[model samples]
Target: MAGRAIVVTSGKGGVGKTTTTANVGTGLALAGRKVVLVDADIGLRNLDVVMGLENRIVYDLVEVIEGHCELRKALIRHKQLDNLYLLPTAQTREKDAVTPEQMRDLVAELREEFDYVLIDSPAGIEHGFRNAIAGATEALIVTTPEVTAVRDADRVIGMLEAYDVKDPGLIINRIRPDMVRRGDMLDIDDVIDILRIDLVGIVPDDQDIIVATNRGEPIVLDQRTRAGQAYQNIARRIEGEEVPFRELAESSFVNRLRRLVGIGNKRRKAN
Candidate 1:
């Protein structure tokens, strides 16, 4: 059977879209799924660097799409996981270098060999974004608990609906339990209420994310961090497992409300 293609995107920058992609991709790989990660943000590829395979990239997405190199030559295997691979985008090339049809074709080809293909989309609704989701069978929208980020995520959700991507899920990243308790930041309830999408994951604000990124290691490798656990849950959820959302250390009013409405706790119990 052909594998799945997922595009991880956010309409706004600095919302941890790429980080979410890397972690979730790695999480899925660690779960024993053969995976391939595509850096579709041409001219600004960071997925390779984040995955710690930047130096090994001799050929890239453009090269494969443009027929300069075969797909196998373009794929750089991940250091730790033999089944995980990276198809980095060309930093010197523009987004227009590869067409959407080409991207779709490449993704279709990848499906023949891998169990999952995750595409890291650029932050925008422009040509790069189009290229990123061209072949995506599923979508993951990443956003921080902020008004601007939520607004942008709403816009991206609308676009995904227009594109007819299947069952797009939301990832709420950089959440601060303290800020949520103090009413200083947008809570998970507020974001879900606004976006009105199925929740896939909630990543806590953890400094280990920075340390992991700097070391070119995915946060999901940490095992002890809540952020890592959150991603692993997300990967399982994506695999059609009924994984419950993790309750924050101190359940906020929002968490209580979610349970009271049978939106979170009751559903989790039913599942």
Candidate 2:
């Protein structure tokens, strides 16, 4: 079967669209799939830096689109993973440098060679965002549990529906279980009630994600990180595996005791 093209997007900034893209691409590649992560932000490009391929970018997407370089010349292979590649964006060029038609063509060409093409979309429903979603077979909407992020995600979902994008899934990032338990934050049910999309993954807020990003490495590379495990789960879910959602509750002993008591009560009720 031909590879699938997916766009990782969010309507609001700092909601982890780029981070999700980097980790998902890395996870998929680690699964033995040939994946190409395209940075669609153009002048505001950061996926290259997140993937640690910034210094090796000789020809960017704009250069390939404008015929200044061949497509093969623009792709930078990952240092450790042979299946992973990055098509970096030109920081010198603006969003208008490449049109939606050009992006479609570029993705079509990539589809022939890659098992997955993950587009890292820039935030907002603007020209850059349009170019990113133009050729996507599906979209993965990334959002936080905050009201502002959920509201923006709803707006982006509406726009994608208007554009007729298929099977757009939701990834709720940086969810705090303690806040949810304390009624201080929006929980998963609350987010699902508002968005009304198939849930792809839930990533808890983790400090390692920050350190990994700062070190120009995707969190998925660190197998011990909870956030990295979440990303891997998402990649597996994307591959059509029926992986269950991770338990995002606090690991207090009292919480475990309560669970045990609840199970005992349930057994008695069954009897």
Candidate 3:
């Protein structure tokens, strides 16, 4: 049976696309699915670093597509999960290094082996973006609650529709409940109203995501932070599981104090 090839992208930069890819891929692997994360952002590869597989990368997507190395040789297995792997892109190669046809063919080959293939796209509608979505059977668009991010996400959704990638799900990242309560930022309903796509996940503005990235680990493995829980739910949703979205309430003074004092810090890591 063939596996699913899903492209995770955002029209604008700095919208946590790569982070979403790493966490969701890890979460799926934790669910006992054999997964491969393909870094399609040639010349600006990041999935490896985000997953802490940077040092282990000897071959990349360009090399595999170009026949310089075998596909299995290019896939670096995850440190903790035996089923999770990463196919990093070559940082020295340009976006034009791999054509859409080659990408589609590569992903077809990947589908034969893994249960899921998650492609991390670069932030743009250029050659890299086209190549990234060429092989995708489904798509996930990541965006923030900001107007600019939502606008760009709308543009990307249009482009995806043009390419016949229908019904791409939306992932709202870095949402601040406090800001939404104060009317300082766009709320989830507002963003959803604009994009008009099925909401897949909503990640809160948690500092633990930054800490996890700094430590070369994905936030989904922790589950202590709200953002981590959100990513895990997104993974389950991807598997066609009916996981309900959580209500993100504004943090109270006592909750903030509890977090600060580490009084309620014991959170069971998601398996």
Number of backbone collisions per candidate, in order? 0, 0, 0
TM-score (C-alpha, index-matched) for candidate 3: 0.94
**Residue range 25-79, candidate 1, lDDT tens digits:** 9989888899999999999989988888888989989988878899999898888
Descending-lDDT candidate ranking: 3, 2, 1
**Candidate models: Cα lDDT each:** 0.87, 0.89, 0.91
Model 2 clash tally? 0
For model 2, residues 1-271, the per-residue Cα lDDT tens digits are: 6689999998999999989999999999888899999999989989998888889989999999999999999999988788899999999889999999999999999999999999999988999999999989899999999999999999999988888896699999999888998999999999999999999999988887889988888888765567777898999999999998864743534444765465312211100
182: Cα error in model 2, Å:
0.3
Tens digits of per-residue lDDT, candidate 3, 222-271, equal: 76567777898999999999987773853545556766788754643333
* Alpha-carbon runs more than 4 Å astray in model 1: 250-271
Per-prediction TM-score to the true structure, in the order listed: 0.91, 0.91, 0.94
lDDT for model 1 comes to: 0.87
Extract clashing residue pairs from model 2.
none
